[model samples]
Target: MTRTLSIAIKENIYRELRKLVGVGKISAFANRAIEKGLGELEKEQKREKEQLRQQLIEGYQKRTKNKELQKTLQVYGEIPNERNEYSLSMVGLPLTTDDLKKFLPVEVYIENTPTTGLDKPSKILCDSPFTWNKGIRFKKRLGVVSKEIIEKVKRT
Candidate 1:
């Protein structure tokens, strides 16, 4: 299905097209060029649209994950630190301030709280299910706190 159409072009461009393709074959050359250019443009547009769609999907997934995290954090409540700073939840993990305080020493928990972005207790110590010291090393300030020092401290 071929339709006749009239269009104007720059004089220099028209002259170059006439010389390169010949005046008699200009229609064929122009038709082929237009088809090739339009195909490339369509392909580029499709790629761009797909990329945008993927980005939107990723963004939606992140928002959904964040909402779930907020709900989980609310269950643990806020933990009060020695410095009076409190954190309702920790990022990247579901561990709460009270959970961290259970295994960590009074002093070591205080030191690591700011670095780990979690809260700690002032003096209270509680029985923790975590018996190993390896899991409590959240930040650079994790050090061995003597049992005597931890026991001597009074609960606040």
Candidate 2:
């Protein structure tokens, strides 16, 4: 057996319901709304996450660039003479022998000779890491080398 009941709704609410139903079935309309809302929320969340990631990367780059620039600047000031070769003591910049080789010329040797002092000599030395010596030749030469270029080269 089946039974039917009639119910009354406010005029405005009834009009709105009728309009919605006219566009599509109630179930279909509700489902579409739910799907669209969820999709929009997801897209918004993804965009936020991407933005946060970009911000973090940019912050890290800025910080590292600043540190590299500072190191390069300190070394730039201490350009060594022929007698006083550039040493790690000039600046606290952390660089490997390979890095120096890649950035500088092949003639530059990492001098391991101990200097007479209480301060232990550094493992790596350069005839002129910042400036090229007369004997040294570079495969590629930059017109003007700066701390920024050094940092960028190292990053690559």
Q: lDDT winner among the candidates?
A: 1
Clashes of each: 0, 0
Among all windows of 10 consecutive residues in model 1, the one with the lowest summed lDDT is 129-138
* Per-candidate alpha-carbon RMSD to the true structure: 18.1, 19.2
- In order, candidate lDDTs are 0.45, 0.40
Q: How many clashes would you count in candidate 1?
A: 0
* Candidate 1 local Cα displacement, residue 144, angstroms: 61
Tens-place lDDT per residue, model 1, 47-138, is 99767656755555565534442222221211223422222112221223455435554322333344333344332333221211111222
What lDDT score is found at residue 95 in candidate 1?
28
Pairs in steric clash, model 1: none
Segments of candidate 1 deviating more than 4 angstroms: 66-156
Residue 131 error, candidate 1, Å:
45
Instruction: Please give each candidate's TM-score.
Output: 0.41, 0.33
